[model samples]
Target: MQRVPKAALLGAGALAIVLVVVVVLLVAGGGSDNDNKNAAAPRGGATQKQGNGDQGDAKPDASAKPSLTGSALPNGDLSNTRDMKGPITSGNVKDLQAGWSLALGQESQSQYGSYAASPVVVKGVIYSQDLASNVSAIDLKTGEVLWSQQYASPDQGPNGVNVGGGRVYGATADSAFALDQKTGKEIWSRKLIRNAGEGIDMAPGYHGGLVYVSTVPGNNGKFYGGGTKGILWALDAKSGKKVWSFDTAPTEKWSKKNEDINLGGGLWHTPAFDGSGGMYFGVGNPGPFPGTDDHPWGSSRPGKNLYTNSLVKLDAKTGKLKWYYQVIPHDIYDWDFQNPPILTKVKGRPAVVESGKVGYVVAVDRATGKLLWKRAVGKHNGHDKDPFYASKGQYSKLRLNEEIYPGRLGGVIAPMSTDGKYVFAPVVNNSVTFTGQDKDQATDGQTSTGELVAVDLDTGKIKWKVEFPTPAFGATTVTNDVVFATTFDGVLHAVSAKTGKTLWEQQLPASTNTGVTVHDNTVIAPAGLAAGQGQTPAIVTYTLNGK
Candidate 1:
């Protein structure tokens, strides 16, 4: 289990009031092996217009007025905006009452692995999967299982699911597969990795007639050594045939220190697609986790690590590189630029925005990959320092007291919300220390806190902010007047979109680490995996009752 470092603000004296959650669930203890970002909270039943219909039908009409306000479908598409305009308002969010809750998956020997992947609701049925590779289609209205099916062997379960073209798409550690949207019948499955270590932990992106999948073993355990690689694959959606593949960690002949270094450029989230069919995605950190085993801190895998720690744009039709933006060069802090880049227009110029675990949100020209503007959304005290390590087997070689902010876990792991004009990104402000190899030696030296920052899309300016008790680990969804966010501490806060003021909140039984789904006038989210609780995971739903 990954040890969560304790933290407190260094000097900010309680600058705000602590909001209490009114709706609480009775939850037991459990945890997830993977510390993934939660899905956005369910938006109440609100039907919004689709952007230019589907990408397969035609390109997004450039002249069409963008759907700047109101509720849109949640997680139905993989652009990763996390901003599906919903109908939930600050005025009515308090009226949200629990509807029903149901557990997902088979009984696991260990309770730690819950549904890290968010459930995708299509045609009134919820498509969800467990770590054990069990996929089910449930009735959205009655919270009853409609049809349950497992993605046979070689499938390690999916990190998340996406829907399009009358099919459900997902990827496991070693493969990417599709299922019939109506029946859970196996459509087709393709093996992504033959090697042992590398697997996929991303949701597949489906558009036109193609499916995009990413594979890596970067987060399997600790960075071991070289020989492992990350890859991006594109396939025909109709038939599971390879269209093309790109090696994220391609070999570079210019860097001398590249010898014997394991370069890791894993794509951890769903890739974003733009109006013109351009694909955008972020790369994870290069490894050896601490850099002590390879060529030393900042020295191994020399030179930008090519595509790692970078935002890459690809041609959706041929899987060719269109442009690229490297967020940080030679990263050693495990600050992977793993969040999906959200697409939008700035001043009528097409642009894409992305934020990672570094607390930096950047906007770049969508077609050119040129940096437009970048902003540090929160307190980022971290500066690259020489990673220290003693001889193997010696605890004295470790830097036990070294504090790094925008800590490895700080930054924006959760997805952001947008109002067409502004983007609400969640940031965690905490510092971390490397006590020993995979060992927990010290607690957080400073307080671990976070803030919900609203960024003006045009200029990357801070519009407003609201501090949270803990890091917001789930996606933030928004309507016209309200913005919703969830914390690792189990509280979901609904704040005003215009003023960033807290309007309502509900205390869940366990922390939400997956996106919440609000469709057809109902709100549902995964409320499981309470630390040490070993609780069974379930998808809980709510609606505006007695309205």
Candidate 2:
């Protein structure tokens, strides 16, 4: 997302803050510590390591079973890969033919709304939402609409949709709801957040009879204007009633006595739930960006900004903070820890992997939040040039207008995929010049490149990387032999997963910023929303010509 630059109330410094907010939207886990009585079991299970990074001879936890509502890939069940497994073999995916196409909603540039999420396909039906948060269910085989529901508010664009507890779940600007899966009739809709300026922008997660939704502030300080804020909420999946809520920003440490500038730390992605009742979520950055005049370095509402720009694990049933790992503390770069933390086994040990706008992908011990290994995946000019790249004492340098590679929009912003052994991440490489003017708000007009890199989950080592002509957004899907990546320019490229060789490519209807889902012999994806490019939101399907 892009924005018009804003000027600071106090002058240039204010504009710097304004400049920072635009980059904030460009886009956008863990476990441990405290305690959750309902937590399944310490994620630490004993195992034997093999010479390969893949899990080998690991004793399986009888309790760890496939999460029916977890992310589903066409290859097989996502949970079946605890040993770093992958599709048995790449199917006959080559020589494809376009299947049925459906228009979910009209893309609106004025509203900044587009169909940007991957559709949820379950039980022979496809569930999705458009930029306006219009919810719909379509037949998986025939692009026929089963049911459609529209929204009047532009703020209601849904980030994604989920299905569980015999209902379909989705979150709009400020509310979370569940609709009858078959009828599309609203079962219950709850305003999870009071401030209209704050809304839920990630797909809801379900487990143990509970549904989870996270909130993100409106663009361009809509949150600050309404004196709004952010939080993580849990609800009864069956009834949409509030269960427990966790404030991303707390008043005790993050507030200004006289001002209303305390904000930021929006959750912009889906929460990962371990079957054991441990939930992992990533928190966004702190507010007023760059820094306000009062606090030049953006440390105004400070104290490590508990929970902001960190990976948090909570007890699924009680929303109790268990443990957290802050990736970027007092983040001035708007580097959101917005990516999902993937729960998997590393060398026979339970581990969590996450990557963010900082270009570094990390693996941590699930129960302890201890670093296993961190590797820089995306391309960057150099970290030495980043003003806030200091490993220690980043707060000392609160200077304004410093340049950085993998600059706000340059790092990895989309979701990554992982087979039991390797993690597939789509990388965005570009240089961002932060100018606090209404003109150059962000990478609104900058050029960016993309790369698809495969990293060994066990060693954090790069196996193979393929670069592209345009920057990549959305999610990456992997089959046994092919890795599917959609570029910002609407080109869906299928590269050989084992060798990074180009296998096939298809041009979509519009700029695509989401991932491609291949189920069985069919591939499903949605196209809309490209920063400066106008949108024509549509769901595109592709199937093996003969299949």
Candidate 3:
């Protein structure tokens, strides 16, 4: 990964602290009254209501059989050859000898909100964070809530939740926390220095004995008025003690003189780790003010802005930068390059594939950030195009118009799913452009519908793509060679992963962002409706074979 210069690094640090404080206060101040309103509810389907007893210890039905028996396309790479062991196969369900069942649970409101943070399943216990600022533990087999605890600060966003070594780690605003996974008890918490006004929207990546969390400066107080920078922390997983810190942007003496150059790129996504101890992640849009004069377009500051919009490889043990590939050089649009870089193989090569807001699916060498192939997956409008390639920071006078593809939400809003043979990409269609001074005053410009696309993992060819009437926000889950996704119209549909054929469809109460999770014969989704309405978000579980 490239390193930001010293002067710029200092400014970014100051900006990050201020930004986190402001975003926290803003989040904490605004939504307290209606916090409970957005809580999740149960979906209307074949659900098992927990009886008046210890919900966690409920026994599974003797007739219930496991629905899914397979492995996730291990580490995002398809060609790596993992020992597949799940009940699902590539053939049709009717061709199988065994029958399956689905069960629904309306206990929890929402599973995970907004971003695509994969839920952690440890020791048959599932753990995930909710939009309501609560961490919940549920029985994987039965949709029974084991324990849940809400945080005092409503503004704190629990971006990442992971369970390892009997401890669960999560990041809320500028602080990182550890809790007992079984009992949901706090082990310890640590407060990091964030930018005064910007919010830190990142999940912590856990590997080996350390936890890696990303932070953005400038969100401590109000709005993100001040500039921000990106910082990564390595902490002791159990004790919550700092091990080492890597500043993507390092401070410099002359940074104060040039405020535009002082802005640091924000790290808004969780870092991905290779089993061999390599870490990978991307950065968010550049700030304090985007599209400004000081930091002209396509300017790459050495050291300080090393990994923004760039896929970075780092040593997990030492927190050292190894390699990087910039997806968009000096990104202009708010096209954050922070989507989880799914580690998968393409064409029998060990590769890492990532879908960015720019609407491009890039496959690169996992060991070395070498570009293998790049394909535009979304519609391109041709906005800014330049033929001449100038060196980084050397402003080129050449201007060309290029089509803008994918348009922010059109790219991979959800994580990519694979059955080793094919990759399923959920293309979001929420074409509503938000423009306003504040969130409340923002206008919903237009509504762009969403789609689910199946691509050949080996050839990058489209197998089949299905468009949805309403926008689909949650990630897709696969089992028994069938893919499942939910939309805002309160509908759940299951499609064949191999042929993209609709196998099952059902309607619920509202739109859902929580991705579907499958355990045994049951499929679960967490969802909610718009605010001020009499609807609450819910965790709807469904049994595939209903009476």
Model 3 spans > 4 angstroms off: 1-118, 155-158, 217-224, 249-256, 259-268, 288-290, 293-305, 384-405, 430-445, 529-534
Residue by residue across 81-152, what tens digits does model 3's lDDT show? 111224433343333221121122233222222222334444455566653335666655554656765552
TM-scores of all predicted structures? 0.81, 0.81, 0.73
Steric clash pairs (candidate 2)? 8-14, 8-15, 29-281, 29-311, 34-322, 84-420, 84-421, 173-199, 481-497
Query: How do all the candidates rank in terms of TM-score, highest first?
Result: 2, 1, 3
Worst 10 residues of 1 by lDDT: 6-15
When superposed on Cα atoms, how far off is each prediction in RMSD? 8.3, 11.3, 9.8
Each model's C-alpha lDDT?
0.59, 0.60, 0.49
Clashes of each: 30, 9, 92
TM-score of candidate 3 against the unseen true structure: 0.73
In order of lDDT, best first, we have 2, 1, 3
Higher-lDDT candidate among 1 and 3?
A: 1
User: What is model 3's C-alpha RMSD?
Assistant: 9.8
TM-score winner between 2 and 3, please give it: 2
